[model samples]
Structure formats: structure tokens, C-alpha cells
Target: MIRKLAIIGVGLIGGSMARALREEGVVQEIVGCGRSKPNLERAVELGVIDHYTHDIGEAVRGADLIVLAVPLGAMEATFRAMQDHLADDAVITDVGSVKGSVVEDAVKVFGEAPAFLVPGHPIAGTERSGVEASFPELFRNRRVILTPLDNTDPQALQKVEQAWRHCGADLSYMAVAHHDEVLAATSHLPHMLAYSLVDSLARMKENDEIFRYAAGGFRDFTRIASSNPVMWRDICLANREALGGMLKRFADELHGMADALEKDDAEGLLEIFERAKAARDRYIDGVE
Candidate 1:
């Protein structure tokens, strides 16, 4: 059992994890660290944390487990500040969406001092943020992926798995490179497309028409586009290579669609739409 846990960010995901673990008695104590005093205080008031601190090192002082829950861009800075204070036997993990850059940046901070650092990503999030947006069961039934490097400690990796399992999450192990490639297709590229489409539409003279006549499909498609811009921007930059590759593939498919439309290829268009419909239906029915 993890007796002490320190979370570097007390926003939606971090706060929710703190609340979930504490509610389930998975951890005896949780210290939330963030720049906002009010956010930290609100987290404590919500019973999500046992203590709060603006000082990163102070908050993680004696924690047996440390979760770097900030934005992907903030990983390096956060790790640098907390590296000096990590407990000798602490197992470090993160809730970053993109793992490749995080793992690469964090290795130096952890050093070769028999440290156990595991980079993890949870394929789950609400379209909300901040301390007020958290709930105890946010990760319940969600898939949590841990991307461990070659040098990761077996015992430490197991402990990280145990923590996620205790949070009611299903676990999967992946390599950092493969994780980025898979996520580029399943998550990042879609978000970028959504943001692009929304931005393009928002620039139209009849923007109101697009939003006013939006159906459920439009709403669902653009939901992630409404996510925090700063966070998403950092993710795009951090995982630019894989995202760029996916974008190229998307462009190729788009050219095919354009060609079909230009040539009045009704059969091709129908087949394309059918493929999309079949794929979406299967996903909706949880067939995948």
C-alpha cells in the first residue's frame, strides 16, 4: 500500500486521482503541489488532498510515490524542481498524454541512483479542467497505458501498475516510441483535425450558422477541440514527429476524397462513407 503520494499538479486529472485513491484508502496521505494557492486549497477542501503546497519540493518531500501531473511541456521543469526532493525509494510516474518526450526529458532528472521512474498515460479525460472539475471515479473503467523504458525497475513498474489498478483502471504496457505512434493515430491526430476544422469554420462569415445548426455528431467531433489550448499546443509540439507523420497520411486520404469528388465518383464516395460508418458503428458498439 502506498502511504504517501505527491501530485505535482492539482488540476482535473491529478485532483481526481488524489480523490479516488484517498476515498478508496489506496494512499494514507496525499500532498498536492501547484502554483495556485486557491487551487491547492480548493483541492484540499474537496477532500482530494491531505495537504497542499506551492513549493514543489516541500510537497513531495517524503512521498513514497510521486505523480508528475502537469502539462507535457511542464514535465522537464517540474522534474528538475522535484528531483532533488524525491524519496530514496519513491516510484515516479506521470499522467502525460505524450510519453516519448517526457521519458526522454525525465531520465536525466532521475539520474542513475537506483531510481524507478515509469512514464504513464491515461486514455481518459473529461472535457473539463481545474480543481472544481475533478471527481473520484474519473478513471474508473478507463484504459491506462504505461510506457516503460529498457532500464525501468520491475518492482517499481509493478507498483505503478498496482496504483492504476487500484484506481479502477485497466493497464497496458507499451514502449515509448510505439506508444507515440499508436496514440498519433488514435488520439493526437484526431484532436489536431478537430481543432483545425473548428478553427476553419470559426473564420467563416456565417460562423453562427455552423454552430446554430450543429447536430450531435458535430458536437461530439469538436468536443476535444474545446480542450485547453495551452495543453494541446504543447502536446502537438512535443509529439510533432509522430503527429506530423499521421498528418501526412491524413493528407493522402484527403486527396483521395478530393479526387473522388472531382471525378463525380459516386461509387467511390459511397464506399468511403460506408467504411467510415462501419468503423464508427463498431466503435460505438464497443466491438473493437
Candidate 2:
């Protein structure tokens, strides 16, 4: 029943959401807002949005739902700009990977985390970005986590949940701190490792040969390294504390593996390998 849906950042995630909503006939009109005029124009041309504007206020006015799909770094400024322009009963949500910082910024800009302001993260995306890379089925069968504060309104939370459900997302709820910590390990740290591994290998003396000989495993493991740099940069910085803790644990495990290798402990290496394989198998089994 969204009369007008306004997306603040009309990139891949936002464009995908708009497309999903349009397919479901949940939104009557979609308005796109971004800093780049050309990008917005392209979004309109692709029919990802009904109209485009650089003015945040103009885009959000009369909109019942506003989705902030911008990078983590630009959230505070975007929230501040649109705070006063939002309709009285408008529901504000975001697709940001980090939740704690997003909640804090929302409180800072809106005086508190109102029930209508739900901090969310859709556990879905590909390495590609931009409006052209968007697809309506991107969220199908994917998990969407919503971290709603204590002061958040039940009705507002339900509305946001239903919207995601309409987009074919499975919904989960968690505390903001818990969400940040879990995402740090599952999403943020993995991306960091991918980027680091790729960068380190690319700087080797025989870099060309290394890449040329890389197999599917290497390509699959580092696929996320091709993600948007600025986006990951902001996420890593914003969740630095949690990500740092995860990195330390990861380093310790790596050291354990190194110790086993140095001692030629085949048993130890096999145990670690088997345990990892078991864990991954369990996850795949559950998901499938």
C-alpha cells in the first residue's frame, strides 16, 4: 500500500528493491534520489524509477516508505538531510551492512530510533553494482535482518517486515549489537580477506603467472574482492571494532595452521580441514 516509494541511492540494491516492489505492485510510484545526475537519469531511462532527482527533500516528500541504499559513509548526511522532509508517518529503513552505526546515526538525526525507523540488512548481493546490474529476483529466498530498537513501533516494524516479505525475502530480527558482531564475522571479515588475498597475490613478482594459473577455487574465493571499493571501505571502517576482533581470531587460527605445517603434523592439518569441511557441509545442507 505504499503510495510513493522514494529510494535515496538508486544503485544496485535500491534499484533491485524498486524493481521487486514494482513487480509486486506494492508501490504506486518510485522516485530515485542520488548525488549523480547521470546515474539518476539512467535509472529513469531503465524504468527502475518513475522519476529522478538530486534533491533529497523533493524525492522524499509524500513518500510513505523511504529506503536508504547509499554507502555506510554517506548515511549520516543523507539521514540528516531527509529527516525534516519525511512524511509524519513515513517508515524509514536501510539496506546497510552495518546496523549499530546506522542505528546510532538515526538516533542522532531523528532524536531517537523511532518505531518507524527500522535498520535492516538484506543478506544478498553480487559482486556487480550500479542500476544496470540490478534485478528484481535478487532478494528471492534471501535473508533480510531487521534490527529494531525498543522504542520502535510494532506496527511500523510489521509494515517493514511485510514489505520485505513481498519482495520474497525471509525475515529475521536481532539486537543491533548482535547484528553488527555477526555480520563482522560472516560478511565484513570475509570481504576483507578476499580483498587482502587478491591484492597480496597481485603484488607478487610473478603476479601475471599466478593469476593465469588460478583455478575456479581461487576465482570463487576472491569474487567479492571485485565489489565496490568505496562501499567496503566504509563498512570496514564503520565496523572496525567488531571486524578487528574477528581479524585477531582469524590470525590466531592461521597461526595454528602454520604451527601444524611447520611440525609436519598431517593429523593436525587433517583435523582442521575436516572440521571446516563439516561446518561448510552443514551450512549447505541446511540452506538447501
Candidate 3:
């Protein structure tokens, strides 16, 4: 059990983890750290953390487990700020979506990937932010991927794996590059498309009418567009290489569909629609 767990950036992801750990008695204490003192104080008052601090060094000083839940862009500065305060035995982990940039940042800050520093991503969250939006059940039945470096300490890796499991997440392991590519295609691309579609529609001449007539499909598809812009901006920038590649491929596919429609090619349109529907059904069936 973690005697003291310090969670940096006590927003939805961090607050959820703290709530889950506290509920499960997996940790003795949780210290919430963030730039906003009122947010951290509110987290404490909501019982998401035992204590709150604006100082990263103070929060992580004696923590055996430190969870970095800040945005991808903030990883480097946060690591540098808390490195000196981290215990030698402390196991460091993060909940960043993009792994390649995170791994690179770890190397830059520490000169190498420390055995105790584990890069992780929890594939779960609502289109919500802040401490109040968090819930203990956020990670329940969700997938949490860990990308461990070659030099990672076996004990540290196992401890983090166990901790996520305790939080009700199913664990998986992947290479950093592979994880980045997969997430770029699966998660990042969809979010980008959603934001673009919503933005385009909202700028139309009959914008209010368009929204008024919007049905369940538009609402469901653009739900993620309501997510924190800063977080998504950082994610897109962090995984730009993979994300750009995926975007190009998606654009090619869209162009093909448009061409088929313009040419009045029923077979081509049917082939594309049928293939996508079948693929989506198979994916849903597999997940279910």
C-alpha cells in the first residue's frame, strides 16, 4: 500500500484516482497539488485528498507514489520542479494520453528514463474537467496502458500495475511509439474531427437553425468537442507526427467518399458505407 501518494494536477483524472484509492483503502494519504489553491482546497473539502498544496516539492517530498496528472505540455516543467523532492524509492507515473512526448520529456528531465518513472495513460474520462467532475468509478472497467522503459525497475512497474488494478482499471503494456500511433488514430483523430465539424457548423449562415435542428447524431458525435481545449491542444501538439499521418489518411478516405458521391457511383458509396458499418459493428461487439 502507498503510505503517501502525491497527485499533481488534481483535476478529473487525478481526483478520480485519489477518490478510488481512498475508497478502496489502497493508500494511507493523498496530497493534491495544483497551481490553483482554491481548486486544491475544494478537492480536500470534497474528500478527494487528505491534504492540498500549491507547491509541487512540498507535496511530493515524502510521497512513495507520485501521479503526474497534468497536461502533456506540462510534464517537463513538473518533472523538473519535483525531481529533487522525489524519494529514491518513489514510483512516478502519469496519465498523459500521448506516450512518445512523455517518454522524451522524462529523458530530457532526468538525462535518462529513471527506473522508477513509469509512463502511463488511462483510457477513460468524460468530457469534463476539475475536481468536482471526478468520481471514484471513472476508472472502473477502463483500460490503463503502461509504457515501461527498458531500464524501468521491475518493482516500480509492478507496484504501478497493482495500483491501477486497485483503482478498477484493466492493465495493458505497449511500446511508447506504438501507443502514440494507436492513440493518434483511435482517440486523437476523432476528437479533432469532432471539433472541426462542430466549429464549421457553428459558423454557417443558419447556425442557430442548424443547432436547433440537430438531432441525436450530431449531439453524440460532437460531445467530445466540449472537452477542455487546452488539454486537447496539448495532446494534438504532443502527438503531431502520428496525428498528422492519421489526419492525412482520414482526409484521403473522406475525399474518396466525396468523389464517389459526386460521380453517382452507387457501388462505390455502398462499398464504403457497408465496410465502415461492418467494421464499427465488429468493434462494438468485441468491446461488449
Candidate 4:
């Protein structure tokens, strides 16, 4: 069990994790650190964190596990702030969507990637933000991917894995580069498309009429557009290379689809749709 848990960004992911650990009785104390005092106070009032601090050094001073749940862009600064205050035996992990960027940040801050840092990403969340949206069940049955460096301490990695397991997460491991590429294709690309689609629609002359008559499918497809803009902005910039490659491939496919439509190639369109449907169906079946 963790003697003390420190979460740097006590918003949705961090707060939910604390609640889950508390529910499982795996953590003795959870102290949150964030810029917003009101939000931190709310986290305390909700019992998601036992205490809150605005200072990073104070938050992580004696913590057994430190979770950096801040945005990808903030990883470097957070690491720099807590490097000196962290206990030598404390296990550190992050929830950043872009593992490559996070690892880079660690390397820059510590002069090399620390052996105790285990880069992780939980493949679950709603399009919600802040501590108020957090819940203990957010990670139940979800996958948590850990991208440990070559020098990562085995004990540190195991502790992180066990903690996620206590929260009902299925654990998996990947190389840092592979993890970034996979997340870029599966998560980042989709969010980018969702936001682009919604923005495009909203900017049209008939935007009001279009939204007024929109159907459930439109809402479902653009639901991720409601996610926190700042977080996604950081993710996009952090994984720009991989995400850009995916975007280019998607753009080419869209052009092909458009070509098929313009040529009245019903067979080509049907084939594309059928393949996509089959792939999605298989994925759904496997996950469900």
C-alpha cells in the first residue's frame, strides 16, 4: 500500500485515480497540487484528496507515489519542480497521452530518464474535465499502458502496475515510441477529426440550421469535441509527428472516397463502407 500519494494535477484523471485508490484502501493519504485553490478545495470537499497544496514541492515531499496528471506541455516544468523534493524511493508515473514527449521531458529534467519513472496512459475517460467529473469507477475494465524505459526499476514498475490493478485496470506494456504511435493513431487522430468536423460545421453560413436539424449520429461523432481544449491542444502538439502522419493518411482516404462519389462508383463506396463496418464490429466485439 502507498503511504502517501501526491497528484500534481488534481482534475479528472488524478481525482478519479485518488478516489479509486482510496476505495480500494491502497493509499493512506492523497494530497493534491494544482493552481486553482477553489478546485482543489472542491476535491478535498469531495474526499477525492485528503489535503491540497498549491506548491509542487510541498505536495510531493514525502509521497510514496507521485502521479503527474498535468498536460503534456507541462511535463517538463512539473518534473523540474518536483525533482529535488521527491523521495529517492518514490515511484513516479504520468497520465500523459503522449508517452514519447513525457519521456523526453523526464530526460531533459533529470539529465536522463530516471529509473523510477514509469510512463503510463489509461485508455478510458469521458469528455469531461475538472475534479467534479471524477469517479472511482472511471478505470474499471479499462487498459493502462506502461512504457518503461530500459533503466526503469522493476520494483517501481510493479508498484505502479499493482496500483492500477487495484483500480480495476488491465495492464499492458509497450516501448515509448510504439506507445506514442498507437495513441496518435487511435486517440489523437480521432479527437482531431472530431474537433475539425464540429468546427467546420459551426463556421458554415447555415450553422444554426445545420445544428438545429442535426441527428444523433452527428452528436455521437462530435462528442469528443466537447473535451478540454487545452489538454487536446497539448496532446496534438506533443505528438505532432505521429498524429500528422495519421492525418495525412486519413486525408488521402477521404480524397479517395470523394473521388469514388464523384465518379458514381457505388461498388467502390460499398466496399469501403463494408470494410470499415467489419473492422469496427470486430473491435467492438473484442472490447465488449
Measured against the true structure, the TM-scores of the candidates, in listed sequence, are 0.95, 0.97, 0.98, 0.98
Writing each residue's lDDT as its tens digit, candidate 1 over 73-164 gives 89888888887887778888999989988976776565542348888998888779998998888899999999877778988999889888
Against the unseen true structure, what C-alpha lDDT does each candidate score? Answer: 0.87, 0.92, 0.93, 0.94
Superpose all Cα atoms of candidate 4 onto the true structure and report the RMSD in Å to 1 decimal. 1.0
Clashing pairs in 3: none
Please write out the lDDT profile of model 2 over residues 1-288, one tens digit for every residue.
Answer: 889999999988999999999999988999999988888898989889999888999999999899999999999999889878888888889999999889878778878776789899999999898898999999999999999988888887887898899899999999999999999988999999999999999899999999999999998899999999999999999899999999999989899888999999999899888998999998877876
lDDT for each residue of candidate 3 in 232-287, tens digit (9 for 90 to 100): 99999999999998899989989987888899999988887899899999887788
Better of 1 and 2 by TM-score: 2
Candidate 4 regions exceeding 4 Å error are 285-288
For candidate 4, the per-residue lDDT at 54 reads 91
Regions more than 4 Å wrong, model 1: 108-115
Residue runs of model 3 more than 4 Å from their true location after superposition = 285-288
User: Mind sharing the TM-score for model 2?
Assistant: 0.97
